[model samples]
Target: MRIAILGATSQIAKDLILSFAAHSQHDLVLYARRPEVVSQWMNNIGLVDRYLVADFTAFSPAEHFDALLNFVGVGNPAQAAEMGASIFDVTLKYDDMALGYLHQHPDCRYIFLSSGAAYGASFDEPVNETTQASIAINNLQPQDWYGVAKLHAECRHRALAPLPIVDLRVFNYFSHTQDMEARFLITDIVRAIRDKTALKTSSDYIVRDYLHPADFYQLVRVLLAAPATNTALDCYSLAPIDKATLLTVMQDKFGLLYEIQHSGVAVNATGRKPNYFSKNKYPKEFGYYPSFSSINGICNEIEKYFMQDNLY
Candidate 1:
């Protein structure tokens, strides 16, 4: 399988690239606005033939290449707000072009990295594919830029109906390569613990489910292999580990517990919050189960860290 990834710098992209590359049957082609911008990010994307420079900012399918996986998207609110004009052009217009390519190619399968915020946040319930979406921008306004942009993108992908699309409402996924300052609570907690003997968060850490990078890639690869899309089977949370468990794992792994603060109320996010996801269906369909969750991967990462220096 030859896979082409858009936004090669993305977390999902990095993981999927490595997964695709590791398989002798897969050949990956990476695309982004600038190769040099994320050359450091694509260290695992060694199998890619070249970094096809194309910007989602200007929805020009002619500018981008047709690949198996179109795993490029931005969910950062500040960034999306800044990219106001580009957001519409890329998410709506050009995104369709990419989908059309997938639809026509017969060989290409589109796997979009989306957010759970697309589920509409006001309703506090575990969401499944049955949940309805609120297409109103007003409903999504308070959800933050990242949520709004992602919902908009997901909506656009859905709108390009009559085409096969895989809109994965990915939850909190942490990777070793992302910027340390990003908003991921686990990464932030890890950073804080690394920064000082005592780890602290200004508020009781929000419970976010986590998915490991390896499992993420497997999920994507399996979905692509089967070419199931525009349906519940393709769209899913990467894999989940609830917040309490995540924090507990972190504390146990590092042996550092700190004065965690709390604002008292739930930290509301915009749109829907189906942050909880199950890999059961995906695993059943593809025979792949993620080897790690938040805690599962932490211990392994720690073990590998110590072993590198023969500390075992």
Candidate 2:
């Protein structure tokens, strides 16, 4: 399969490239805002021949690809806060560029890396494709811009795009390549385990799901091959993970220590309700189930950071 990946420097995009490159039959064309960085990374991986260094707006593929994955966006909350309304404009601009490209090549399957934020500020229950998204009418803040932008892009594509497209509303994802300095739950746990430090949290009553990086690409491959009909699928692993059990396992297996400063708080840090898991048809529709459970996935990541001598 021939594919073109936009925002190729993204962590997820890089993981997807490494995953796809393992299969000799899959050919890839990569584009990033920084082509030199992408070229260096791809060259290190020994698959630099299929890459082109160009910005999203200026990039025009020489030939049609079987699929195009758009992984572009301002993901950092701090950056989103700093960028303000420009976040929405930048996001929609890239979406429009990709959609226009898809318009010219109607046969190309389009996969967008949307966020669980598209569900809006509510997380009272497990979000499915059927869940209605909310908008903050009275309290629109800088942090809300990212989610709002994603919601708008999803709406725009579903209503207007002429080609086959699937917006994978991703929740939590963790891997070895994740920045250690990032204050994510998984990274915090990994770093604590590595340094033998105690991890304290306000509460562990909240529940969520985590996807293995490999499984993410697998879902994309399956959906890329499937008939895309303007659909939004909640991207999650099969296993539902809660904070208490996850910490328990880490403590038991790796002897990591954690303390819950408070309990009885069901609400997450987002101030909205928490979704234990997401409902999707990846298993039934695509026969795709993630091989790694939440614990197994974390252990795999831990092993990569601490135990494994050779980089994968």
Predicted structure 2, TM vs. truth = 0.88
Model 1 agreement with the true structure over 233-272: per-residue lDDT tens digits: 3233334555666666667766656666654322333333
Candidate 1 local Cα displacement, residue 97, angstroms: 3.6
Q: For model 1, what is the alpha-carbon lDDT of residue 268?
A: 37
Q: Per-residue lDDT of 109-219 in model 2, one digit per residue for the tens?
A: 888888888777567778775778877779886656777888888888788556688888878787787676665666777767777788766673667788888888788
**On a 0 to 100 scale, what is the lDDT of residue 279 in model 1?**
34
* Candidate 1 residue spans exceeding 4 A from truth: 40-66, 75-89, 103-107, 135-145, 155-162, 202-206, 232-239, 264-283, 286-288, 301-312
RMSD of each: 4.6, 3.2
The runs of at least 3 residues in candidate 2 whose Cα sits more than 4 Å from the true structure, single-residue gaps closed, are 46-53, 75-82, 262-273, 309-312
Clash-forming residue pairs, model 2: none
**Candidate 1: Cα lDDT at 79:** 50
Clashes of each: 10, 0
